[model samples]
Target: MARFFAAIGLLNLVIFSTSFLAAEEEVMTNSWHVIFKRDVDHQTAHDVANRNGFLMIMPMLGSKREYHFMHPQVKSNRKKRSIRHTKNLKLDPLIATAVQQAGYKRSKRGFKPLKSLLDEEKPIESINAFPPKKGSNEEDPLFDKEWYIKNTGQAGGVPGLDLNAEAAWAKGYTGKNITTAIMDDGVDYMHPDLFDNFNAEASFDFSSNDNFPYPRYTDDWFNSHGTRCAGEIAAKRNNGICGVGVAYNSKIAGLRMLDQPYMTDLIEASSMSHRPDLIDIYSASWGPTDDGKTVDGPRNATMRAIVKGVNEGRNGLGSIYVWASGDGGPSDDCNCDGYAASMWTISINSATNDGRTASYDESCSSTLASTFSNGKPGYKDAGVATTDLYGKCTTKHSGTSAAAPEAAGVFALALEANRKLTWRDVQHLTVLTSKRNHLEDPTAHHQWTMNGAGLEFNHLFGYGVLDAGDMVDLAKDWKTVPERFHCTAGTVKGVYKFDSKNALKLQIDTDGCRGKKNQVNYLEHVQSFITLNSTRRGDVTIYLTSPMNTTSLILSRRPNDDDNKDGFNKWPFMTTHSWAENPRGKWILFVTFSSESEEFQSGNLFEWTLMLHGTQKSPYTSQTSPLIHNTKSKLALVKRQHERAAEFQF
Candidate 1:
């Protein structure tokens, strides 16, 4: 009789727990956010919501006047009904706006795990062991395989084709006193390799609406992305777990915004601006679908949050944002990805262990630098070694996803060396210090070009692979760059037509806002805001030539972009190819249609405007040989030699 009573008690507890969870899920699913007007008092808003059978949850994060509310009478699965209720809420005079809370999938930039490629099922003894080399201090078993950190060519990789992390480590700059936030699915804070460095105070879960950003587990371990990325930045050193991080002493914060049914602008904004005062760097590896056609970017709220973060975060030093240049390969152009192309973010591309462009790398002028990812097949232990989900470790992290965090780790080291570096200062350091290692474009579409300012740049590799040692050395003595200014050089307003056979060329001439407060002499980022309509948008290619005769292919042909109705509406096609160049003469633009479909297509250029962003005075005046005067002639000679060599290859 006693045993029977105990079983009944257990049954009742299970029933109660199930009922409570169901209620909580119902509340979460039926939630809607309503932005109240400034004039509406909280008491009045509460009374109105109560009269309408709504219960207040709380205020939305990163929003001033937005409040979350739920209607008990509304069914959780009735999305259309929930949306209708929000529409009705918008009709109230006290409410400024309303939106139903929902979830959407944010694509992880890393390649999905393949059973054939992954060695997760293999026993520890079955994997080939790489003994640590001489003078190595890392005791972690996987350190020998981390070629990107200190490449010794353990896996058929080229020696010294690495980020030179050891050099920075030698200088005792291991990202101390800095925090980097990984904005992804969620982080395994409990993982032994990362637990020591995880900053719980700066972490949050917008998806689950909780303070704990722990990843929700699954059978297939699909949510290991954030954990891997975090491990790349802050996994503990000499932990006897996994390989050491590039910034092993830096703090890691997990902002869990992805891994939901659908993504909302509020979630994105909250993640981007979360604890900006505490989180110095925001590392993001996810973006719009890389299906070779999608053109998407941050929404209005997210855009505002990013702008606010960079302008006001980190005690006005500006929050640093590192982004992954998309992995859409040769068919897609990253110029369409606004997040990567934005002047506010540092877009990073990927190179392989062999120092070649990754097979899936997308070429664009906006990519700021390159980092090592994974090598080709048949190379032993070529993938990145980092911590995985559930206290495990992985040797298969690959993609621009892996590359971005490494760049973030490098930036963290720089920050530790100099805490006063602003967002723009980091970009300047990257352009000035990044090296032209052995990275090459296998497609041969983009060759190394020497700008008028003598800076070498490539569409595939940007300025070049990051050199942590050089970056830190420069950061230690780096002065804040001159205050940035924007100048509108010229605008050409007219409709010009072009067909497949004949290309359309337009020119704009101006003094670059000379004799004004916003005068720009040295160039930084150049933007060509264009509006056009094409019969087949995918066939259109746009190129811009700076006054210095340096040409930038701002927009390449996207064969998969078949949309003909939308075209481009004042799309800001940007390029860094003209960095440090003068913008005071005639600028030329060429728009042509190239297609193999045998379909004759035409396009109309509705308007063209040239915008220049730089400083009135030279930013390099503090350094020796300002404007790279000593290298100009040498660079020009190399350019001519390269052109001659290309002539024979073609």
Candidate 2:
């Protein structure tokens, strides 16, 4: 809501060494960030902040445009809008000048009214914005959206939810017009398969509002993850297509909410507008853990907006919002906490392709038990079948990050089936139709204890895994009816319900432990059933760990600050260019051009800090450094082969 202005200043571009050589003249050997710093002649910094035109145009390999940021010297117009950038190349230079005029001093300071060159030779003003063009070396076959949709070359073909089958059989629905808003880094809007499905009218980067998200393949971060997620949500039905989507015909809308600082406000703003009938489903593959933990912190702006939308969403035209439960759990005191599954409004859990649960899946370990998304490893809840942006078919999708969208795709199908169903109704029906693990209970332990039954509501796996067919059937007879129930731990003596007359107090006691390790035994079981789908390497072996005994879970990323002038640092003590190389686990190492020097600067903020992560062997390390000034700076995670990226980590 705050306006900003422009002020011209002297410009200086900072360059960084690249793994690939730049075009000679534009190269900066030991520098990062091709910064352009200029000064405004007479205009004050606040002036530029007001118009929100300030742009800092250094080349980014990922999405084409950037959410331009004001040079630190500019007025305090730090809201996301000020940092907006666009993919419309024609307008890049003009916007660049307006951008420079806003802050950077590119040339003589007595600036004249800038005329857009877009009208003459290049027309960037009216150019249809999209993600950025790929760099020459960024040869990711995943750029071909159709390839992934087919699940071609993937680890294994992705499996459709049985519930999807049920819905298809009954409703004959394929999500023709329902719109899904994917909240993540910009998606490949122009991919042939995705282009047909994109609802351009509904798409916008609330983070910038003025520009299209820069989606390029050259930057590893800007790879096809978003496209893959969208494919899972609503890839077109077999037109001889490679992959299948939950809602084959749903309209997919791309909203760039991630890849920025303080995305909450932008996300909230997007939800507050006109309830476009087209957007009946808002699928956010990003969020913080509600459990007040470090990695997953308190509710951010986007979350508050979602909650608001759920309660009073868009003039009562509330959209179904689905979230991915995290893969962080199965660890000590790790609960499926916050935004993703924080409230009844949000659905949470992991994916399972073949019914086999893995050791890393973040289970429906919340107050409400939800369905287990199909992971790849059958019988072992590993991952849902998915296409990698890089065009690889993953036999076992490895993260809840993958599972959430798959579920969202299913939710979209339900919307397509019943046009009148509201979010609350959709959630209830999902619960009702979910297949309880206890449907074939083997014994008392697996008796679907706290889980909800069509007959009752349970906590672990809310009502159990959602069935697409059941949802379709319910949509046929849709109404605004919601599940009304409470959990009394059914025969499990440890979970007790208090009388309404007293204050709200939660007292968990393991006093019923008959054996010395009964408490430990129980936790291990929970971890096994739920958190198994996260990483592929680890076995579900809980070592009698609890939050009390746990130290800290630290995350690491590639080094962003090579200067080391500021305390800015990467996560793990050591990083490597080669996967097999042993890291010092001492000094931070980044993706330098090579062994030319011990330290080298990365091209930019996002580029340098990417490709880093922590391991189960060391979930966290004591050493830490963000921007010395504040937390919430852009942080990337280097990923291990078996484990995918974390949504909350960024």
Best by TM-score: 1
Q: On residues 71-152, what C-alpha lDDT tens digit does candidate 2 reach at each position?
A: 4334332313323332221243223432222111001000112242122211111111222243322222222222222222
On a 0 to 1 TM-score scale, where does candidate 2 land against the true structure? 0.49
Q: Could you say which candidate leads in lDDT?
A: 1
Candidate 1 lDDT over residue span 528-621, tens digit each: 8778888988799999998889999998988988877768777777899998777888899999987888888988999887878887766665
| Per-model TM-score on C-alpha atoms | 0.86, 0.49
lDDT of 1: 0.79
Cα displacement (Å) at residue 618, model 2: 49
Q: Give residue 465's error in model 2 in angstroms.
A: 1.8
- Report the Cα lDDT for residue 163, model 2: 40
